[model samples]
Target chain A: MSTTVVNTGTEGKTWGGGNEPLKASYGKMMMWFFIVSDALTFSGFLAAYGFSRFKFIESWPIADEVFTHVPFLHGQELPMIYVAFMTFILIMSSVTMVLAVDAGHKMNKTKVTWYMFLTIIGGLIFVGSQAWEWATFIKGDYGAVQTKGGNILQFVDTDGHRVALGDFVVAEHKDRTAHERKNGLWFVDEGTLPTYTVDEVIKGLESHENVLVRTQIINEEGEKTVLSRAESLKQIKENGKAVVEGANLYVNEYGSPLFADFFFFITGFHGFHVFSGVVINIIIFFNVILGTYEKRKSYEMVEKVGLYWHFVDLVWVFVFTFFYLV
Target chain B: MGHEHKLEILRGLIKFKSNTQKIWGVLILLSIVTAVEVVLGIYKPEALMTQVLSMKLLNWIFIILTIVKAYYITWDFMHMRDETKALRRMVVWTAVFLICYLVFILLQEGGYIEGVYSSGFVKRDF
Candidate 1:
C-alpha cells in the first residue's frame, strides 16, 4: 500500500461527506428532519379527521355553529372570532421566535432574551386559550337528545333559534340516580348522569309550543332538517333514548360523536406540541440568560429551536383551517 | 457565521431590508389571510357556496389560503429559504407529496364508506 493518502478533491465541496453537504450544521439538519417527520405525523391525524368528516358528510356539524362561544361573551353568537384571535396569537409568537433567531445571528443577547420572552408569553396565552375552548366544548351550551339510532336531536324555536334544554326542561321527582361502585356493582361504575333525562326532555317538548326538534341530517340547503311539530313530538316520544350534554369520546351533543373525538385528539396533540415548545424555549431561555451561547460565539441553538417553534405554528395554521374555517 | 437571508417574498415582488423586517412582513401577510378567512367564514357568501370540483368554492379558497400561510411559515419563519436547495427540497417535497397522497386516499375511502353505510344493510337514515 502506498504511504501517500489519496485525494478525491471533494473536501469543502457541496457533495463532501463531512463538510456540511446541506450547508446546515448537524444539529440544524437533524432538526429539519425531525420537523419533516412530525409534519407527516400531523398530516396523518388530519387526514384521519378528513376521513371521518367525509364519512358523515351529510350529518356533520357546522364548525361556525359549534364554535360560537367567546370568552366573557355569554349568550352571544359570535362565531370564528375567538379562534381567529387564537390564530393571531400563535402567528405573533412565531414572528417573535424568528426575530429571536435573527437577534441570535447578530449575537444580540438582549434582543434575543426579550424576543424569546415574548414568544414564550404568546405560546402560554395560546395554550391557555385552547384550554378555555376545550372547557367550553366539554361544558356544552345547548344540550341535545340522542336517538336510539345514535343521532343528535336539537331543539329550535319557530324562528330557527337554538333553545337550550335548561330553558324548558322541568325536572320530575324520581328515585333513579347514577350508578356507583359503592351503591351497586363492586367493580363497575357508571359515568356521571346528564342533568336532565330523556323523558323530561319529551315532556318539555310536549308543553313548549314554539320549540321543535332538529335532526342531525342536513337538508338541501345545508341546514339541519327540522321536523314538523307533530313529527317532532312523535320522534322524541318514540326514538329519544338519552339526554346528551357536552362532548366526550362516546357521546357528543354535536351532530356526530366522531367530531368530538377528532377535535379532542388533533387539538390535544397540537397543544402538546405547543406545550413542549414552551418548555424547550424556557430551557434555552435560561441558557441565554447564563451567556451560554455568548461564550460559544454561535446562536445556532436558538435557530434550531426556532425551527421547532415555527413548525408548531405551521401545524396550527392547518388545524385552524381544517377545524374552524373549512 | 456569515448567514445571509433572501429577504424578498411574493416572487421578489416584495423585499425587506432585514430578517427582522421580513418576519414582520410575513406576519402581516398571515394575519391578513387569517382575517380574510374569518370574514368569509362568518359571512359564508352564497356565491362561493356553489360546488366546484365536488367541493364548495369557499372551502377551496380556505384550503388554498391555508397552504399559502403554511408556505410563508416554512419558507420565512423556519428559514428554509436560506438553507441549501437540497435541504429545502428534502423537507418540502417529501411532506407535500405524502400529505397529498394520504389526504386523497383517505377522502376517497371515506366517500366509499359513506356509500356503503347508506346502501348496505345498515341504513343510516332513521
Candidate 2:
C-alpha cells in the first residue's frame, strides 16, 4: 500500500488551490473586497437617509433654500455653486491621484511626488471647505421659531424676502443666571439661553407689519406657505414655544430636526473619510519621498490609495445627488 | 500594471503614451457631467419636474447622471478598466446587487410610512 500524499494538481503550499483565479495579487483582491464592504456600509447610511426623507417629504426643507450660502459672497442666494465647486475639486484630486499611480508604474519618482502633493493639497481644500459648509449650516442665517408641535416657523416679508430676527427684534437685556450642574440642586443644569425668547420674536413680528410667518410646508406654487398677517399673529401667539436660532441635534432652524441630524451625520462621515484619505496620502507621499516603492520596483501602494480616493469621490457624487440635487 | 505594461487608457481608443493626459481627459468628462447636474439642480426646469414612473423626471435624471459619473470614476480613475474581467465583475456586480436590494427594502418601507402619514390614520402631530 502506497501511503504517499497525492499532489492533487495543487502543488503550491498556499490556499485557493494554488491559482490566482482573478489574475490579481493578494493585496489588490483584498483591497477590492474591503471596498465592496465599505460601499455597502455607505449604501446603508444613504438608504436610511432616504427613508427618513421620504417619511417627511411634505415638510422637508428645500435643498436650494437650505444651502444658499457661498463662501466670500455672504448673504447671497447662490444655490448649488459652492457644492459643485467642492465636487469639482475632489474629482480633480482623484485625477491627480491616478496620475501619481501612473507615474509610480513608470518608476518616475519626481512625477509621482508632484502628483501626490497636488492630491494632498486638493484633499486639504475639500476638508476645509466642508468644515466651512458645516459651520455655516450650524450657525444658520435667519432665525426661526419652534412651535410646541416641533415645527420651525420662519419670517418672510411681503416681498417674499427673508427677515432676520436681529433686524426687527428689539434687543432687551435682563439679568439672568445659568444653572450649572455643580451649583444647582440635584445636579441638573439649564440649557444655554437663546438670543431671544418667543415673546421677543412675537413682539418683533407685531412691530413689523410687513413680516409674515412661513411654515415649512410647500404650497401649490412650489414656495413655502406664508401665513397672512392676522394668521401669523394668531399662530405665533398660540403655538410659539422657543426661539430656535441655529441647528443642533435637538433643533434646526431649517425645517425638520432630522434634516440637521442627517446632514451632520452623513456629511461628517464623508468628511472623516476624506480626512483619513489625506492622512494615508501623506504617509504614501512620505514613502514615495523615501524611495521605498522605487526600491521594490513597484508603485502598487499608490495605485491602491488611488482606488480609495476615487471611491471617496464616487460616494460624494451620490451624496451630492441625494442630498442636494434631488 | 507592472513595469513592462504601458499605462494606456480608454481601452486604447486614445493611447496615452504618458497616461497623464488620459487622467485629465477623464477628469474633464466627469466635470462636464457634474456641471450639467448642478445646472439642472439650480434651474429645475418645469418640464422635468413632472411626475413619471412614481418619481419626478428631474430626480431620475440626477440619479442616472450620478451613476454615469460613478462609473467613470471607477472605470477610469480607479483603473478598474485595466483589471481582469473576472475581478471587475466580482467587485462591481456584488456591490450593484446589494445596493439595489437595500434601496428596494428601505424605499418600499419609506413609501409605506409616507402613506400612513398622509392617510391621517396615524396621529403624528404631537
Candidate 3:
C-alpha cells in the first residue's frame, strides 16, 4: 500500500486560519472572535454611558435609589434585593450551561438535556424580571417639575415623605379646543399633555404649606437638597418650567434625562442579548432532544453554544456591577 | 488535538478528577465573590469610601472584584485555562487593550467637558 501526502507549501505557518495553529477548533475560535468584537461594542456603549454620567456626577441619580422597586411588593423600598435575585439566577444559569457542556463531553445525553432545561428556565425568569423592572421604571412613582435650570424639583412633606402629584396637585382643566385635521391644522396635533401643568404645580405647592421642594443636586449628606418653604415657593414660582410626570427620552422624574436614556439603552441592549440567547438555547435544546449531536458522534455544538451562553452571562456581570453596584 | 486534560485551578492549588466537580467548584467560588460584591454595595462601608486615586476605594474594589468574576467566567467556564496560550492571548488581549483605551479616552474627554460646564463659562442650568 502506497500513501502519498502533498504539502501546499503553506504548512507549519499561521498565515491561513485552517491549520488550527492555536489548537482551537474552528467553530470555537470563531465564537471567540465574535465575542471579542461583541465585547468591544458593549464597551463602547458602557463607556459613553460613563461619560455622560461623569458629566453630571454630582446630580447623577444613585443607582440604588433608582432601581428600588420589587414586583408584587409595591410601596416597599427593597433596594437591590430583586436585582440580586436576578443576578443569582443568571449565574446559576451559567453554572447549568457549563454543566451541560461537561455532560456533553462525557457523552451523557440525559444529564445534558436536564442541565439545558435548567439553563433555559433560569434565563426565562431573568428576562421576565427585567421586563417587570422596566415597567416599574417607566410608570414612575413620584412626579416632579423641571426647573428652568434643567434640574428636577421633587415634592416632599415636612416629614420628608415623597408626595405624588396626584396626592396634592388639584389641576383645573382649561377648556381649550383640540386641534383637528378638518380645522386646517392637520400636522399640528398637540403633544400629549402632562398630568399637571407648571401653573398647576406652582398652585399646588402654594396650597400645601407643609410640602417643600427637593432639588436633584445631591448635597454633602448624599441626599437631594431640600429647600425651605419660602425657598420652595420662590424657586417654583420663578423657575418651574415644565411639569414632568414620568420618564421618557426627554424627561425623567428620577433626575437627569441622560440617566433614563442610558438606562433604557444599555439594559434594553442586554435584554436583547438575553432574548436571543434564549431563542438560540431553545433551538439547541430541541436539537439535543432529537439526538442530533449523538448522530454526529461529537457534542462540539453544545460546547460552542455553551461558550456564547457564558459570554452573555459574563457581560451581565459587568453590567450588573457598573449599572447597579458602581 | 493533543488535549491537555490536567484540570487544575488557582495555579494548581486544587485539582478536580472530573469536569463536573470542577464546574461546581468554580460556581461556588464565583457565587462567593458575587455575595461579597452585593454586601459591599448594600452596606457601602464608609471607611472604604474615602477617595483614593481620584475615585472611592470601594469603587476600586468593585471594579477589581468584577474583573475577578470576569476572569473566572472566561478561564473556567469557557475553558480558557485549558486552551493553548496563543488562543488565550489572542482573545483576552484584544478585548483588554481596546476596552482600556476606549474608557481612558472617553473619561478624559468627559472630565474636560465637566470642567467647562462648572467653570462658570457656560450657563447650562439657568
lDDT (0 to 1) per candidate: 0.93, 0.88, 0.87
TM-score of each: 0.96, 0.93, 0.93
**Which wins on TM-score, candidate 1 or candidate 3?**
1
Q: Give the interface RMSD values of the models in order.
A: 0.8, 1.4, 1.2
Across A1-326, the per-residue lDDT of candidate 3 in tens digits comes to: 25655656876677733666677788989999999999999999999989997788778888887788888888888788899899889989999998898888877899999999999999999999999988888888888999887899899999888889988898797765556667767777664567788888888888889999988888876678888999999988889898887687888998999999988998899989998999999999999999999999778888898999898899899899889998
Runs with alpha carbons beyond 4 Å of true place in candidate 1: A1-17
Best prediction by TM-score: 1
Tens-digit per-residue lDDT, B27-93, candidate 3: 8888899999988988988899788987889999999999999998999998998898999999999
Query: In model 2, which regions exceed 4 Å deviation?
Result: A1-17, A182-186, B1-18
What value does the TM-score of chain B take for model 2? 0.86
Report the lDDT of model 2 for residue A320: 91
What does candidate 1's lDDT look like per residue over A1-326, in tens digits? 69787777897776766766677788998998999899999999999999999898989999988999999999899999999999999999998999999999999999999999999999999999999999999999999999999999999999999999999999888788989989898898889899999989988998899999999988889889999999999999988998999998999998799999999999999999999999999999999999999999999899999999999999999999999998
Residue A159 CA displacement from its true place in model 3, Å: 4.0
Model 2 agreement with the true structure over A46-153: per-residue lDDT tens digits:
999999988887888998999988989977899999999999999989888988888887789999999999999999999999999999998989999998999889
Q: Where does candidate 3 chain A have its weakest 10-residue lDDT segment? A: A1-10
How high is the lDDT of residue A60 in model 3? 85
